[model samples]
Target: MKPADSAAVALLGLTVLGLAAPTAAAQVEPDPMVAGQRVRISDGRRCAQDGAARVSSRLFGPVVLRPGEGGMAAQARVAEGAAPGRYPVTIHCASGGASFTETVTVRDARVEGLNAAQAAGGLALLALAAGAAFWLRRTVGGRS
Candidate 1:
């Protein structure tokens, strides 16, 4: 197909995919990243009702839960001063309990940096698929 036809078909496919995609409320991806900006961490499990009296020293602040009912979540921040590498996060409870640790990566991002990565990955995939399609088309033509 011509370049214009190919581009139009691709655009139309994207339009359909966008319309068919699930709503934001259904997102189940781990909260490693949020708001296309801040990264978040949770124990992936709740703390005890009384809470962790002693939090690990490595943690930024006291691991406190939302004061109310439901699953208790200990909170910490991936601060702006924090490095862009992965940090080991551990939640310690004082009541002779086992602690849970999670490694959360905080990335330093500028709009241009993310844009470049997305564009590069998309182009690489497009190139690979176009090459495969050309090979398949050639094989079919040759066999016929």
Candidate 2:
């Protein structure tokens, strides 16, 4: 092959490799979960130290990250009553002070429909109040 042709082939190979290989930006992963749901993440990067690993969010709670296998596993529970929306997740790597941030979406549980337990409880409370009111009216009115 000609020198120029060889150069072109090398450039093409580099471009293909660049597209095929996953970059650092692609390594960070985001897991989406509903309110009160648990999400697990498996990360392959090792941090600087044990205490250096951290994840945080305001809507939910702190992420419990543990070293496992060749990487790390993170467990985070979404707040039971957290409002449906996108929340920011911040991950702190123990090594090199590197941080990663991603957004997780929380879908409203109520969006599906009314919860049976909540509806039943509300109805029961309403009936009890009505019965108490009837009793009060009968007694205070001096009626049988």
Following a full C-alpha superposition, what root-mean-square deviation does model 1 have from the true structure? 10.1
lDDT of each: 0.48, 0.59
Clashes of 2: 2
Model 1 steric clash total: 0
Per-residue accuracy of model 2 over 6-66 as CA lDDT, tens digit each: 5457556756875798633212233335777766644446454365376767755666556
**Candidate 1 structure, TM-score to reference:** 0.41
Candidate 2 local distance difference test against the native: 0.59
Query: Which regions of candidate 2 deviate over 4 angstroms?
Result: 1-30, 44-52, 110-144
Q: How far is 89's C-alpha from truth in model 2 (Å)?
A: 0.6
lDDT of 1 by residue, 8-121 (tens): 576668668758975431111233432234333343344555654334424255545332343334445444465566656665544665666556554565422344557797
Worst-scoring 10-residue span by lDDT in model 2: 23-32
Candidate 1, residue 137: CA error in Å? 24
